[model samples]
Target chain A: MAKKSIKIRAKVKEDIVTVKALMTHPMETGARKDKSGELIPAHFIQEVVCESGGKTILTADWSGGVSKNPYLSFKFKGASKGDMVKLSWADNKGKSDSVEAKIG
Target chain B: MNLKRRIVLKGTAAASAIGVAGLLAPRAVLAAWPEAAFTAKTVPEALEALTGNSAASESGDIKIKAPDIAENGAVVPVTVTTSIEGIQSISVIAANNPVPLVASYNMGEGALGFVSTRIKMGKSGDVVAVVKAGDKLYSASKGVKVTIGGCGG
Candidate 1:
């Protein structure tokens, strides 16, 4: 699979940068069943990390209990316009992707 | 898969070796992922595995923001913020989910005690946010009703 799983936006205002990201995922909780009534195996992002200019700002540990195509937003200090902010995620199945966006 | 993880770890290490700015300062130590905690069957068990405290006291200082009714259990927005100082970590639990523990975050020094994310719900139930601060744990909870079950409901 391609590493195009995340869409991110960041904007800096008054020295603080707010970041919002949308992740593409099924986020299956393992308890879900298909139309055929067979259980769908668990497939969900287990880790997410956000960084600004090569520095880690946030790291998250998640489970199947997280909703599908999860959206996340957070803020950090000391960011400037046009700075690169990268967001990455790793799933329970060992699939992972990362994307970078410039602070607007 | 192992190779991919190894590459990522190597990149992090390389960044640390360069000794970047304060914002990028390498943590003296980062805690290992607590796999056992997230796998716990019960909420108390999960909490005990993560914070060593299953009997966390409820506190008004901790706030959990979630909708009273979630139209889609597949994606419910949840935000947790606390006024407590010296917060060490925050954990989110969806009581009705097959695996109740939704997410957990470790707070580094100078990090804010606030987090916002989307979580899944198998059904209508209480969404709990637990904060560990200086050996004590505090939590806040709010009931959320799911109109469309996320876990094949």
Candidate 2:
């Protein structure tokens, strides 16, 4: 596969797991123009899903209004240490990437 | 010879079509992304597209944490937390953005009613947090002053 663009970390404290993720993306809005005075086509992540142990814990639907290199943080319960939490995102251009982190 | 070449081209086209379908299959399996809501130009339009209702009652239970003044509009950190039970989803809206709706998060079982992320602002405006709980929509907003616009290149 291509080089991963998503960095995710999951930490469990007192039966609650906090997941923080940073995704490397330009998140272009298509409204802005380049130095050449050309419009940039909108290219951004449209959906992000987080799952653990075969169950989805959260799903985020985003637009180009999200900043570049988006950062997301959320918390969940019933997950223990050492369990794997997977975070994945799909962009508007049909490109996607996912990463899994073991809870610490 | 020409007939045989035409047949080969047809077979290749069919194979490529199947390949394209395979690539898009996963996206269809996931929950459908709300396109109309994301493209809405105003907060009421976005809310109507997302929840089928535009009227949201202001609630004190929802908390919006953001800076009073953001130096850079490109990355304004925002967090939304709510104490409402049976929370279904949380949506963040930057009122002055070209497309006001920033992001919407659906909470599954075991997920807390909290979300933190960064959004872009075209200008200084209210950052609204809309929370859906038990089929009712509640919202709270905080004003954010942006010194520099994020959408301008």
Candidate 3:
């Protein structure tokens, strides 16, 4: 499967910062079945981390039970306009994808 | 007369045993919830138990944005927002999902009352949104149909 894309849009009001992101990838836990009763192998994003200027804001460790294309919206303090927000997701097979969004 | 009393007592004891077995039956029956909805099947079950009996309903205050039709079953976009105040959490449940509750976000203190995310849909179904505020439960649901199969099919 292609690596999922993560897009972040920052909604700022006064001193509060809200970051929204969507990652395009299948979080397969290798435990599903098909119409034919065959088992689909497990493929999942095991860890996710969102960062602001070297400070960690959120981290996620997904199990095989997580749905595909995990979407997350989070808030953080201390970030202002033009600051950078980074999102990354890594799979159990050692594959990872990362992207950065400049706060708008 | 003593023999008749003994037989009656045995029947009553047998009936009580059957009653105990009946009460313990439903626990095993609900145990076979879907296996591949996610890595943790317990997540959905726990969320349902948290919000008792409140089914998702439509409201102007709540909006669920996912593609009217999904191109891939493996990845689907979902967003939920509410006009209500003091929101404590926002949770998504796929009404037809094998394990209904997809994810739950416990809001930070004084946090905004909206969230957006992409979730996996094994098949077409309504995405149910549950919001917690004012110490009450509110919900809304939107339908998203998956067009193409994306489950390694």
Candidate 4:
């Protein structure tokens, strides 16, 4: 079984829900060379989507310029405590991971 | 001679068919990745591909928060916030990086005009934040000094 790659947290305060997510990825730019001097293929997350209560709230498009183990933070309204928020990301190589957390 | 002309006609038809499909492919996939924009090398080219227009007005409504000096270029924290109403999206561009456009965020209904993330910088440069509101684009930028480059492995 593959290990999970995404960790997410959500908390509601004053009718606003704040979400923070951390994703583990190498985020290779294809410009880097390995110890053997072979060019590493570009492997980076291209899109990240956040949803709450079955509704999409935020969508992010990223390039390889993003740092390794990218961390993202954002906020949205119309959700309350105990509501579920899901964060997902898809890389350029077609790999993806998603995780859900309840608003604290 | 007749067979050669027929083959040329058939090739043209096939090429046009593939061209039409290429134009319609992005729409078929909902929320498809913006490949052209991300792959763009220059800042103006990236902005032009991401937003319809490359011209953006400098505005005080947008705020960019980042360190004046980064000890490590591999993980420089950045946050963009705007008071502009009806924000459609926000994009971060590291002007000196190999690929200037770092990330773009599309806000949904009731979402705030703020985003915080970390980016890699090849060297010291200005970090520009562009906010799209309604049909207008507003931008703000801040300079960050990097002690070590992040791109070279």
Pairs with steric clashes in candidate 1: A67-B120
DockQ of each: 0.21, 0.36, 0.14, 0.41
What global local distance difference test value does model 1 have?
0.77
Question: Between the candidate structures 2 and 3, which one is better when assessed by lDDT?
Answer: 2
Docking class of 2: acceptable
lDDT tens readout by residue for model 3, A1-104: 36447766876678778887766666654434458866444556656667777876655434433456566776656788988888887665566788888887
- DockQ for candidate 4, C-alpha atoms: 0.41
Residues A1-94 of candidate 1: C-alpha lDDT, one tens digit per residue: 6768899988888877878899999886555446996655667777888887667787788877777888887777767898898888877666
**What TM-score does each of the candidates earn?**
0.80, 0.88, 0.57, 0.87
Off by over 4 Å in 1: B1-31
True-structure lDDT of candidate 2: 0.87
The model with the greater DockQ, 2 or 4, is 4
Candidates arranged by TM-score, highest first: 2, 4, 1, 3
Comparing candidate 3 with candidate 4, which one achieves the higher TM-score? 4
Sorted into a CAPRI-style docking class, model 4 comes out as acceptable
TM-score of 1: 0.80
Clashing pairs in 4: none
Q: RMSD, each candidate, Å? A: 11.8, 11.7, 13.6, 10.4
* Docking model 3 quality class: incorrect
Query: Ranking by DockQ, best first?
Result: 4, 2, 1, 3
